[model samples]
Target chain A: MKNLRLKAARASLDLSQQALADAVGVSRQTINAIEKGDYNPTIRLCVSICKVLGRSLDELFWEDD
Target chain B: MDWLVRISGVVALVCIGVMVYLIVKMSPDGFRKEQYDERQTLERLKAARAGFYAMLIVALIYLIVTSFAPELGNQSRVWMCVMLFFGIGTFCLYAIFSDAFFSLRQKPWLYLLLIGVNLLTQGFNLVNYFADGGTLRDSVGTNYILVLGMILLLLIIGAALVIKMILDRTERD
Candidate 1:
């Protein structure tokens, strides 16, 4: 359940977890947790992250069957 | 001597309070209250619950022990110190491992320095106590045990934080 899509998107943009977390106003650990699938972020956070990474929710957060 | 002990205890308490206040004031959050993200907050809540349960269990054991030996009731302060420190240690260890103990703006090194100073102070107090031929049941018995417990708890939490940091460094995002 790791969010490799989110990780890839973050890497494509050259954003470290700390940078992404700063952009989203959260701790780096939170970003790490999200990428590791250890935490489920709220939709609001999802939107924020999507906006930051220039990605759609479906692209970064959606799980494939 | 008892009065001197009481004064020293008050002074130590005041110093600790001032140090905590200064730390909060110096925090980047500026005393508005340290901010934690949703996940950290959730983890902290769980840690708090764990600490509460730990304290409850400790208190139950203390009660049972005191009931069996009514004379131990006179050392209620020491038992209370144990219970409080045990709960605090539980909370600290849980939060440290969960990465929820420090706010985003907090400096762990600052806390580590503070703990070191407190530990040194407590160690000195303990040395002085023993030097004065003090027993665990003396007039300042509670103070002695309280200082000892605080030192032990600080050492544990400090060690946990150090270990967590080392582990975190090896973890890739």
Candidate 2:
């Protein structure tokens, strides 16, 4: 369940994991965990990441059936 | 000689007190780092759980061994202390490498400082042991176990740091 959508969004912005983590006030490892599907972030963090990437939650975290 | 031991003992006690104070006051979120996010906190809890179970198993084994071998029972306290030290060390090292203690972006100098202190104390213990005409058999007490445990902990931390550095470098490249 890797978040390829989020990764692509981050890449489009030229943001490294550490950069995004800094923007979100988290460690790069936390970002890595999210991308790797190793951890599910809270909705609050989801909103934060969406805001940083200029993406809506649907764009970054939502999955289609 | 007695005075030297007493002074060093007091210094060690003071150092432990300072450590407790820092841990209690500074580490409201554990390890006092901003990088300790939810994921890292979860990892820390997992590591703690694992360490606890491992320590329990080791203690049980020690109990069984000592009970079976009464001669070895005399050294039970030393062995138990060493096991506890290593158990806690494993938990800490796990947390550190997992980025639960400090963010990878932040330098973990406190851990390095702790390793250095452990080495220094080990040196002092070795010198004192020799100064007291202590034989190899006499080196099986609390002092010896403490030094050995610290050395093992130091090695684990050093290895973890090296691995982390290499990983970071590779990621950067």
Candidate 3:
């Protein structure tokens, strides 16, 4: 359930999880949790993360087979 | 003995002062936003719920104990305080260790310093008690156990904060 696409997007921007978390005003653990699928963030947090990574919501949060 | 009670009283006051200060500091909008987010807030609410249940259980047990042991008549108030302390302390510890309180942005040093001061004051009382050949139970009967429990609670929270600080630092690095 981990968001590998989000990880890739962050890497492409050369941003660490801490950097992204700071940009979104959250703890790094929150970013890590989102990436690991350990926590389900609110839509607001999802939008914030998407905005920070310059990604669309579907690209970062939506699951595709 | 009177001196010991006075010292313990002062230590208790210092601890109360520190908790009040932290509560006040954590109340402001800026501090809350900076140090506490949705996740932390959710965790705190959970902790509070757990604490409430614990308080009920402890109170029940205390009533049972006192009812069964009539010889402990006059010390019921002291035991009640102990029960209340543990009930609240359990929740505080849970919140702290779960990253709900004293997180990366919170100023844990001030709390730690206040706890350290309380510990030192208690240590002084202990040394004086030993000099007079007083036993631990005697000290508690004199109400020193209240301060001791406070010190133990603070130490647990302090240790949790230290571990959280290290973990957060490692994560950032």
Candidate 4:
């Protein structure tokens, strides 16, 4: 459930949660929650995050079985 | 006694007005619409729901108390105000702990300073009242219970904010 792919993508770009949150216009806590599997972000927010991290939606959000 | 009540009311209103002005001044956009992120907004809505339920419970308790003790019916206005304060305190504490109290453009430290000032001002008035041989209820039956309730509410919120700040610092990402 945790979005480790998103976290890794953000880290690969040397982005802290706060940095990513600022880029995506959200609170750092929201970003933290998303990474920690505590919250399910909306598709709109997911797109924003993916765009900020320079990742495709499938690369970051897809949960492959 | 009436003059004392009038002066206290005026002073309290002025303090509140000053706090509001400071909040607006400290905001990034003066007098404009404030905004919050989606998660903050959702958390705030949940906090508001909790506050609504708290108010309902307080009202129910007040109604039951008044029904049993008809004498308290005379002070219904004071009780109503106290109930409102309790509800506000509940909402504020929830939002603060959830990190949803401050908007993106608002500074939490500034707001906390304002709350501290208001608390100290009320506390000073309370101490002065007690020092001047003033009881909770005067001859005209004007009770200072509402003031006490306000002070209690401020204290709780202030303490909660302090604790939340500590937690945020320790849990920083």
Per-model CA lDDT versus the true structure:
0.90, 0.79, 0.76, 0.85
DockQ computed for model 2 against the true two-chain complex using alpha carbons: 0.59
Q: List where candidate 2 sits over 4 angstroms from the true fold.
A: B1-35, B103-106, B135-141, B171-173
lDDT by residue (tens digit), candidate 3, B54-109: 87887787677778986664566566666677777878877876767655575677
Better of 1 and 3 by DockQ: 1
lDDT of 1 by residue, B68-168 (tens): 99888777778788889989999999999998999988889999999999999899999999899987763576678888888899999989989998999
**Considering only N, C-alpha and C atoms within 3 Å, which residue pairs clash in candidate 1?**
none
lDDT of 2: 0.79
Better of 1 and 3 by TM-score: 1
- Of 2 and 3, the candidate ahead on lDDT is 2
Superposed model 4: Cα runs more than 4 Å off: B1-28, B138-144
Answer with 3 or 4, whichever has the higher TM-score.
4
Clash pairs for candidate 4? none
Q: What is the TM-score of chain B alone in each candidate?
A: 0.78, 0.66, 0.62, 0.75
Across residues A20-60, which tens digit of lDDT does each residue of candidate 4 receive? 98899888888988898888889999999988888899998
Separately for all candidates shown, the number of backbone clashes (residues 3 or more apart, or on different chains) is 0, 0, 0, 0
Ranking of candidates on lDDT, top first: 1, 4, 2, 3
In terms of TM-score, which candidate is strongest? 1
For model 3 chain B, where is the 10-residue window of minimal lDDT? B135-144
Give the per-residue lDDT digits (tens) of candidate 2, residues B1-173. 99999999999999999999887887656555454677887888988987897788888888898889978777666777767876787787778677686754557667677777877878688778868976433335556666666677777777787788677676540
Q: On residues B34-135, what C-alpha lDDT tens digit does candidate 4 reach at each position?
A: 778998999999999999899999899889998999788777667777778878988998898777888877777898899889888878888888888877
List candidate 3 segments past 4 Å from native: B1-34, B107-114, B129-143, B163-173
**Which candidate ranks first by DockQ, i.e. highest?**
1
